[model samples]
Target: MLLGCLPGLAAVLALALCAGGVERSVAASGRQVVARPAAAHKAVRPHIVPRSVWLDDDTRHAQPPPRYDDRVIAVFVHHTDSPNGYDCADAPRIIRYLYAGQTGSRDWDDIGYNFLVDRCGTIYEGRAGGIDRPVTGAHTQGFNHRTTGIAALGTFTAGVPVPKEMTDAIAALAAWKLGLSGTDPRARVRLTSSNSHSRYAAGASTTFPALAGHKDGYMTSCPGAALSALLPGIRETAARLQGRH
Candidate 1:
């Protein structure tokens, strides 16, 4: 009877050992799942909208987009140099200043650009979305009525030039706009010294047409020299964002 009980006890000890060993092997093989702490499980980041949305979010005090004369034949670029490039993050504030001056001083009621691109490539909403529509702006000569203005915060005339990221944003926006306007996204959009109808023929298979600096129907340095040199590239990138080949 003692021997029989001994065998039974051994069998029970072996089963316990096997079960324990299997658990240890699972832990050692890195297959054991660790339950997160209760507090940790609740910590997750939320999605965020852009700062441009904040500019347009005025409860009942908001302005509306214009209903007339928005042909948007071209896009112009500018730099906010008077206040300096270091304040790129405060571009919306500058927009407010411009809108005040354009309205109060120059007799227009809002910021000039349809869009403003900051040094860090952040795009902000501008005048085209405002109420009491502006038919005139100081963005370009002979074409402010027909052109869509897009300003970048940096003075890239002689500096190291506009960053490629900025060019990318400009291109993407331009491309998307082209798609909406029923224009060929891959066309060359340049205001030449010889033409006024916007050239959409001289582009690579991947790039969209964009009006280059000094090409608009205006006489001023619209996008300047350095940054202007990158318009073709910008247009191409913008086209791709619209899912064109």
Candidate 2:
């Protein structure tokens, strides 16, 4: 009984020491000294998108079953494929229109993208699930699971100048989202294709940039040429935000 109690006491002592870095110091007089406070690790939280900023209270819909993945490892950038000349003040309305179109006309359960960014760099929350959760989206057909979709709120065909602010916000958002799982934005990750509509057959494993373009997974020229061209820089900026050299 004494030996059994000794082992349990030792285990508790070890746990307590590890919890807060318990230290032992000796003074010149041979008396035990107290430990100094340990420094805290740096926290890197960027702007977290609020759902209220984009989701109107009246955008009523029936609740669909939620889908989620283990974690997010990739980000796919896209363009809304709508006109680019609208005033920034009308962004919410435009987003609502897009949401309605996708849900009502296209019959999707909800807006596909995980997030949306305007030309002015304002980030808006998309989808009906929690932003921090790995909510499986319907944006990129085969690569929806374990990934995030950020749609730039405009048509960005070739020669259409992609806004700097938009890309910057995208980088910040990507950094925060990827950093949550300690994923390197500039790295390549292999994901199994869930749909054959993608470049690879269903269940084929493929390697792609952690920050990928919509076209990388599917044949459609989504995200458009201008925005796609900006993805490399976005990836680099996101990595830097995550403190990657």
Candidate 3:
């Protein structure tokens, strides 16, 4: 009987080795590569954020995202704050910004973020999910395991202020997303708050990562001076949503 089971045991041992190797491979690649959505497949959908919620209608939406996705990490905020005006009237304008202009040679085909928050505080949606699926995009520098993007208006370097409504939108969206991840069967997420240092901070990832500034992880200055300064406040608002406060 013992010899009869030897082959099965060997097979089990081999399988375990393969599983362990895969885990290490994932960690080595970092969350970004593993979490990024495959560009070959994107859904056809539009998620629009009205102007009342925006501080200004100066930003555009990108192409749709995957039909169904759920792995999101931290929220990355930046100041499109571009002096050069963009189409901004609607999502098509956004698609132009992401695909046209200096595509950074990547020809990404869409905006680099998952969402856009304007000066007025209204949130215009970007990166639609595929056919009732979840969505993911490129925004955060690293830590894409469960990350989303939020681009604001005006240049903090140019002396722009991060408004109260902007924070409100961030909190509202973060809360909504966190709750969604917990219940959404389509999205297989692992985090809830902002905890990624590459994207958030140490305490931020308690459940889900916290809202963060683009400069937090990247060397280039982005999200603007005023908005970057408000990272903590944004996180607090999100925390309150989860009863962390």
Candidate 4:
């Protein structure tokens, strides 16, 4: 009887040892997981919109590289004030034409807007400055500093049909650009007026929508009445893209 009981005891001891080993292994794994850096668990960045540079026929140059602002807190939407009827394939040509007029006729150092979008929903890099940097644009009169300018390729006066593709692209661009600074696209930001040309006096601080129309900061009816009407929808779309839904 004693010998039989001894064999059973040995089996129990082996099972207990196996259980202890498993618990130890699990504890070790937990420790290793806890040792990982906090940054390793950070959320992934949001999607970035694709953009194109100057086309083959496009003449792109900035004699003196465009100046840069510290950061962009707002974005102003505009219309190129060009013809609305054109083939999407000819977007590059259209852009080249605009560039020539600005740099050649206007004698500006570079294109005014930081970005341009075609009716086909294509986004183009403008202004000869680094797209990711806060390049000061010549688009807005007094709100250039800490702001970005995105021009829609065609005219959008009152009653003109605004393309869904164009508006969608604009929303995407606004969301991504503002996300770099952790700005909420639906929020309002206060900016100091740099010139008296705009509605506000120079050095006067005023609050404006994060995603604004050209006319929001200036007296010109740029971006058109048709496009201006879409600003609210664009802001909502941008905010949704930034995870603010």
Best by TM-score: 2
Relative to the true structure, candidate 2 has a C-alpha RMSD (angstroms) of 17.1
Error of 3 at 55 (Å): 20
RMSD of 1: 29.2
TM-score of predicted structure 3: 0.54
lDDT of 2 at 46: 52
Off by over 4 Å in 4: 1-58
Q: Which structure is stronger by lDDT: 1 or 2?
A: 2
lDDT values for all models? 0.45, 0.74, 0.45, 0.71
Lowest summed-lDDT stretch of 10 residues in model 2?
1-10
Q: Can you tell me which runs of candidate 2 are displaced by over 4 Å? A: 1-43
Q: 6-28, model 4: which lDDT tens digit per residue? A: 11212322111000011222365
lDDT tens digits by residue: candidate 3, 146-178: 566666644455355566876677666655555
lDDT of 3 at 239: 53
- Tens-digit lDDT string for candidate 2 (1-245): 00000112223211110002345666889887868644332126556566576667687556687799988888888777767787988888877776665666456677777888988998888886787789988778778889988888777778999989999999988888877666788888889998686788889998989898888887667777888888989988898877776
Clashes within 3 Å, all models in order: 9, 0, 39, 0
Ranking by TM-score: 2, 4, 1, 3
TM-scores for the candidates = 0.57, 0.80, 0.54, 0.77
* Candidate 3 Cα outliers beyond 4 Å, as residue runs: 1-70, 84-99, 102-106, 130-134, 182-209, 243-245
Pairs clashing within candidate 4: none
